[model samples]
Target: MDEKQIIEAVKEAKEKSKKRGFNQSLEIGINLKDVKLEGADKINTSIKLPNGRGRDIEVGVFAEGDLNMKAKKYSKHVLNKEEIEEYAKDRRKMKKFAGECYGLIAQPDLMSIIGKKWGIILGPRNKMPQIMPPNKDVKEYIKDLKNTVRVKSKKNPTIHVPVGTEDMEDQKLAENIQAVYTGIERTIPVEKIANIYCKTTMGPAVKIKW
Candidate 1:
């Protein structure tokens, strides 16, 4: 969608979505056409929003020793080897923990162990932890992930991703939406996109003329 149309759509969507007791997230939905939702044809990737989603994105880091110390300093949740084992045993607790964080990053050395133990729980939900080199800076990675939104097409042809919160300016929200649209367009051809829609957490979807 053009900048003018996107701004107009965001304004209309914001107006339609009344303020709630809690801050509501603004989401963008895109429907696909002609693309077969099978195997590698599915859409699954992380896109960084230029204006962010207007919230603090909690990051969980899995590491040990010096790396663990660095990760703990920057991330809200840090899981050491022992803690990872503990979470592995308790599926319920692991699921709850995963739900609380926007994404997870792990020490590269622990990838195999994490995959073997918790892959079943996190993989299906697209919460699989990213691998980070032990020697690399943890703060930079956490900062980048804070501005990212996960977009994936699993069993459905349509995907919805949070662009920003209702509290953000209309222009900023429009820019965020455009960033998401461009990211998705990179994955799938423009002709494959059937429709695009925007909505708030509690509001009805409003179509965007792309």
Candidate 2:
């Protein structure tokens, strides 16, 4: 869904929550991978929140370069044009690529090299080389990324974040929940975002009036 729907959904959900005493604080999440990276700011920013969410998510990138440098580490098998075509036809290669990408990071420099050296090789399959900044606490964030709120709307656009939980402190939960709201707001823009609310993984949503 777009921005307006996002806000409305959140608000509706929050209202429902308050009606029921708002006792249940949910650890909400949203998927925003499909939201698109439209500019160069995300690549350069310390905190990359597509929807303008203020979260300092440090990513560990294993790409080609000085291993001790940033996270721009690399592997021998990036991809080729023919191989990309094969993967497109099979679709299984995507999974294979993902599997082989366990310790790999997408480097901006690699993308440039791929374009200059092997661009024609991987352009068609949309398998462009990418880069990620190294994470200080790679292990902790990686382990908890999926555990955060899992927002699923459409496409493979997945963004998991911690919103709230039943046991969370009121102010703390509210603060976290606001972060989620602002994050979504960043994506759709305030004008487009009509409203917002929250929903449990297996329960109804509550509207946030404030």
Candidate 3:
């Protein structure tokens, strides 16, 4: 879709979406056609929204020693090897942790340990910690993850992801939607994109013409 069409769709969606007690999120849904989801090469990667989702993203970091101490300054939650095991034992805590954080980053050496303990809990939810290279800067990783939105097509031909919130400018929201669409197009064939829809958390989906 062109920029003008996306902006118009955003305006329509916002106008139709009445103001509720709480701020609603702006969502983008894309339905695909003639796409095979049988293999492992599924669309399951994160895309950084150009204008963000109009909110702060909580990030969890898994590290140890110096890296753990350094990560604590930038991450909302930082867990070491022992702390990870402790959290794994508490189902309630683990569940809350999984739901609360937007994404996670872990030291490369501790990935196996995290997988063995929290994999069952986080794997299905797509909250698995992104492996941070040993030599890379943790702060940079956290900053990038904060701006990212996950896009996954596990068993369905449709893709649904949040582009922005109701309070953001229509143009920014449109740009974010375009960024997501562009990212998906790079991975999946553009011809397979059957339909595109934009909506609010409590609003009706408005179709956008490509």
Candidate 4:
């Protein structure tokens, strides 16, 4: 997709959208062609928006020892090994907690436990905790997570992801849309992009006619 075309579409979408009481997220929808969905569930990846997500992204951490302590400083929700086990027992609570956080991080040692217990819940949703490398700063990871948008295309020809918020500048939103488009284009080797649409949370879809 052309960046200039994306900007024009973004501006047109903004102008066409009516004012809302709350900030609406600018989202993009891409329709792909000739892509196999046999293993589409495995097509999961995170892309950091060049201009950020224009909103806060909460990250939940599952860790122990010093890493757990450090994670507490950066994240509001930090679960130790015991708490992880406890969450595993309550499927509803675990699902709710997983939904609350945009991303998850875990100490390397806790990977197996998280995988074995929480994998069933987190896996399908793509909310699995990332294994945190030892001796790394938790703040950096959290900061990056705030700007990251996860892309997953499971058994579907179309991919939809949030680019930014409506309050952001048009150029920034365009850049974010381009970033997601380019990232997905590189991810799924398809014949061609059938169509691309941009819109706010409650706005009409604006098609980029490039």
Residue pairs with backbone atoms closer than 3 Å in model 4 (clashes) = none
Best by TM-score: 3
Minimal lDDT window, size 10, model 3: 37-46
C-alpha displacement of 69 in model 3, angstroms? 2.4
What RMSD, rounded to one decimal, does every model reach?
A: 1.8, 10.2, 1.8, 2.0
lDDT of 2 by residue, 1-210 (tens): 344444455555554554344444454443333244344212111222222222323323324435423222223344433444455555455545544432233444444544554344345544444444454333433334322332323333333344644444344445555555565655444443333446754457454444
Cand. 2 Cα-lDDT: 0.42
lDDT of 4 by residue, 85-189 (tens): 998999998999899898898888889999999999999987888878776788898888889898887678778899999999988998888788778767776
User: Residue pairs in steric clash, candidate 1?
Assistant: none
Residue 9 C-alpha lDDT in model 2? 50
The global C-alpha lDDT for each of the candidates, from Candidate 1 onward, is: 0.87, 0.42, 0.89, 0.86
lDDT of 1 by residue, 45-77 (tens): 789988887988899999999888988778779
Residue range 138-194, candidate 3, lDDT tens digits: 888888888899898968888899998999999999999999999998888888889
Clashes of 2: 41
Off by over 4 Å in 4: 39-42
Q: What is candidate 1's TM-score against the reference?
A: 0.91
Best by lDDT: 3
Model 2, position 206, has a per-residue lDDT of 53
